[model samples]
Target: MPKVRVHNVTISLDGFAAGPNQRLDAPFGDGVGWGDDLHSWFMSATKDAAAGRTGTDVEYFVRGDRNIGATIMGRNMFGPQRGAWEDESWQGWWGDNPPYHHDVFVHTHHLRPALEMNGGTTFHFTDEPLETVLRRAFDAADGKDVRIGGGAAVIRQYLRAGLIDELHLAIAPILIGRGERVLDNLGEGIDGYRVSELVSSPNVTHATLVRR
Candidate 1:
């Protein structure tokens, strides 16, 4: 079976996964801003003059996204929207074609209908537990890989639960002062994993971990 993985989750030197006060304009938070400068490496590496991905980024991008059939993300990662949603008009942060061209299970507090978007992306909202959600995602994956897409809190949940088999982090070069930190309260639960691969570039440091 394909391992549960995480890729390209950019973080500040201070360990902040996202900056504070996320809104329509500043989705990643006021610090990183909506543009997500942390993920700038990915954006620059993938896009070309043709207006779409056309380069070595294709190999890396495909390896990260195409190998997976489904993804699970926290509600906040889906959008800056909070509470009861107020309405269903909000699809997600990505307009029309989302980056995840596969089934995406969004963990939410409030119940919402499944959202079908352009490309192969489909969002399924659920308030289920970690195990329940992963089971559903793996089932939807149809023998392909499943990913626990993150925004810190959710990743920590599964990480502590030993749900993730492979983990990748794109440690960006910046500090957001105060925001959501990815390594908070992990304690010894993090000891089960060990770094298996690492690479360095001008943009960022790519670290891949595997369970020991």
Candidate 2:
């Protein structure tokens, strides 16, 4: 079966995925103490491998892209904009060719025409409910898995719905005092899920939560 999976999601020691006050300038957040330290490991992975960077961080980061046929992300994760998208010029932080070479769905209240980019990436903006989007993603994925690329709120929704099959969280070393929390107020929604694996890299600790 095709699984709904989340991977390489980095969170601070304080359990915040991103700091408050997100804007165009600050992708993660604005004026956070730790800044982008929570994602340092991820940044390293994007660099040339000749940099001598290796270990669990690189291994797990690379694993997130494998066998992912479709991707779903919140509008915030897709871009820094909020509310109505006045400017359609923003094609996401990733350049002309995004890393996701498959169909990518952006969950938002305001929908827009599908934007095709260089490479095989196509951004489909939708206002549909989570279930509907997941259905479409599954159809687009064919037999492959669908990845949930999140910014905390989106991941929390899937967790509340008990729809996520696997979640891989990277706990960074630093702690931001305030920001968005991914695993907050889950209640019984996460009762069926448990940490199946745990490993610590030099920069961050990895925890894999699998549903029972």
Candidate 3:
């Protein structure tokens, strides 16, 4: 069966997935000491791979993209804009050619037409329930897997609904005093998941959890 999975989700030592005050200029938020070096090991690995480097980080980073046919992310991950999207001119941060080369669903209350970019990526904005959107993603994915490309909150909702089949967390060695946390207030929602694997590199520790 095709699985609903989250991969390469990086969090800080303090459990913050993103910094406080997320906005246009500051994508990960302001006053979080975010820079080229402050990103997760997976981010660094992407750059390193381009420079002909290979390591554990690169290995896991590459694994995240394998067999992912569709993506589901929150509105924040699509952009920093909020409140009904007054302007539809913004085409996301990835420019004309986005990274995702498949159907990318953005979870939002406001409705918007499907956006077809230069690459194979098509952004579908919807306010549908998690299960409904996920079903659409599965249909688009065919027999491949659906990735939970998140901004924390959306992932939490799927977790709460017990929709996720697998999750991969890359814990960075930094601390964001205030921001969104990836694993908080789940209560019994996370009961069905278990840590299936744990590995560490020089910059981060990787943890893989699967439904028990």
Candidate 4:
């Protein structure tokens, strides 16, 4: 069975995953950028390649090309804003060659044609239910795990639905006082999740969670 996992997601100490006014210029919000944090995390995660210290972080961040077959992201995560895309010309914020080199699915109410970008990345827009999108992503992954590349809301949905098998959260040291809160509305009983591992790096704290 293919497991659904969320990895490399950086959240602020204030529990905000992203800033409120997210736009093309301010993807992660004003002054709330994770640029340095992300760079540091990626560097550390990839550092052990020479030492053969393969771990979960290395698998998801450094060696993602090996394990990741497909990715699923919310509309906001796919782009800066929401609603029907005004311009079909807007590819994404990641330029002609975005990061993920595998199949990617974007959840949206409005449908758009599949976008083929540089490299092997292809963005598929689907308005179907979450389950449908998950199924498609899993099938596309070819038995490999499907990664939930998110903007918080998407992760919350999957978490509430109990569809996610594993979660790796990179807690950054900074605090965004008034941004999008990731765990705001999480109801009680969500405590079924238990922390399986904790690692502290210079830039962020990595926490791994699994359902109890």
Candidate 5:
């Protein structure tokens, strides 16, 4: 069975995943943004050391090439909200090439055509239900795992639906004070989830939770 995993998702000490006012300029939050907190993780996750030995942290950061077959993310995670893209010109913040080289699905209310960028990455927009998107992602992933690359809201939705099999979080050392909290008003706590692994670096602590 293909597992649904959420990996390398960062959060603040105050439990906020992103800041209150999210724009292109300030995507994460005020002063302390996602960039600052996630710089090490990103560098590690995307770095290919052999070429020049990018960074040591990359060894800790997880990649999709292993068992992951597809990726699913919310519209907010795809790009900064320019208020419903008037055109498909925006490829994303990763420039001409994106990190995700597999099938990537973006959940949105509005529909847009599939975007094929450099490498094997292809972004598909869907206005369907959460379950529908998951099904498509699973199919795209084949028999490998599917990653839910989130923007908090998307991960919350999957969590509430009990669709996530595993979650890997990188707890940063900053405090946002105010922003969009990841675990808010979910009614009851996550029943069958428990921390399975914990690792730490100087900047961030990585924790893994598995569904029982």
Candidate 6:
């Protein structure tokens, strides 16, 4: 069976997965700023690679591309755009060739036509129920793995429904006083997972949780 997983998602020491006061100026919020400190671990991965730095950090970061045939993400992760499509001109945060080289399903309340990008990445937007979108994503995966490409809210939904198979988080040592917390509404008795592994680096602590 294919496993649904999350990889390298950063959460602050204060329990906020992403910072508050989200806006166009600060997508991850001013306190966070996409890649200042909280997400610098991830932001540095590719840059470090280009600069000829290869180590555990590079390996862990690049590992996200492995065995992924399909992915599901919330609209927020897609871009800063919200609500109905006032304009369909926005493609996404990524350029023509996104890192995702497979089918990517984006959850949205508003309908938009399927977008085909370069490098085999195609974005499919949907307003369907969670189960419906997940089932469709699993089917599209074709026995391969499906990754929950997230914003905190999306991950919360799957976590609450007990639909995720594994989750890997890179806990940043920094603190974001306010923002959306991933584990906020996880509810009690939702603890069927065990820590699969823990890897520590100077910048972050990586923890893997796998369903028992």
Model 3's alpha-carbon lDDT is 0.89
Evaluation by TM-score, superior candidate among 3 and 5: 3
* lDDT of each residue in 74-147, candidate 5, tens digit only: 88888876457788788887877887888999999878899998988999999899899999999998898999
RMSD of 4: 2.8
**Tens digit per residue, CA lDDT, model 6, 90-204:** 8888999998988899999988999999999999999898889889988888888999989899998888888888888888998888989877778852587789989988888
> Which tens-of-lDDT digit does each residue in 104-186 have in candidate 2?
99999988889999999999999888999999999999999999999799999999999999999999888788889999999
TM-score (all chains, Cα) for each model: 0.90, 0.94, 0.95, 0.87, 0.88, 0.93
Q: How do the residues 81-199 of candidate 4 rate in per-residue lDDT, one tens digit apiece? A: 57777888888878999988889999888889999999999999998888999999999999898988887988988887777888888787876688787666767535768899898
Query: lDDT (CA) for every model shown?
Result: 0.82, 0.89, 0.89, 0.79, 0.78, 0.85
Q: Where's the lowest-lDDT run of ten residues in candidate 2?
A: 30-39
Model 3 residue pairs with clashes: none
Per-residue lDDT for 201 in model 4? 65
Indicate whether candidate 5 or candidate 6 has the larger TM-score. Answer: 6
**What's the lDDT for residue 46 in model 3?**
88
Model 2 off-target regions past 4 Å?
Answer: 32-35, 48-53
Q: Pick the candidate with the highest TM-score.
A: 3
Give per-residue lDDT, candidate 5, residue 13.
Answer: 68
Better of 4 and 5 by TM-score: 5
Model 3 is weakest, by summed lDDT over 10 consecutive residues, at 31-40
- The TM-score of candidate 5 is 0.88
Better of 3 and 6 by lDDT: 3
Cα misplacement distance, residue 174 of candidate 1 (Å): 1.7
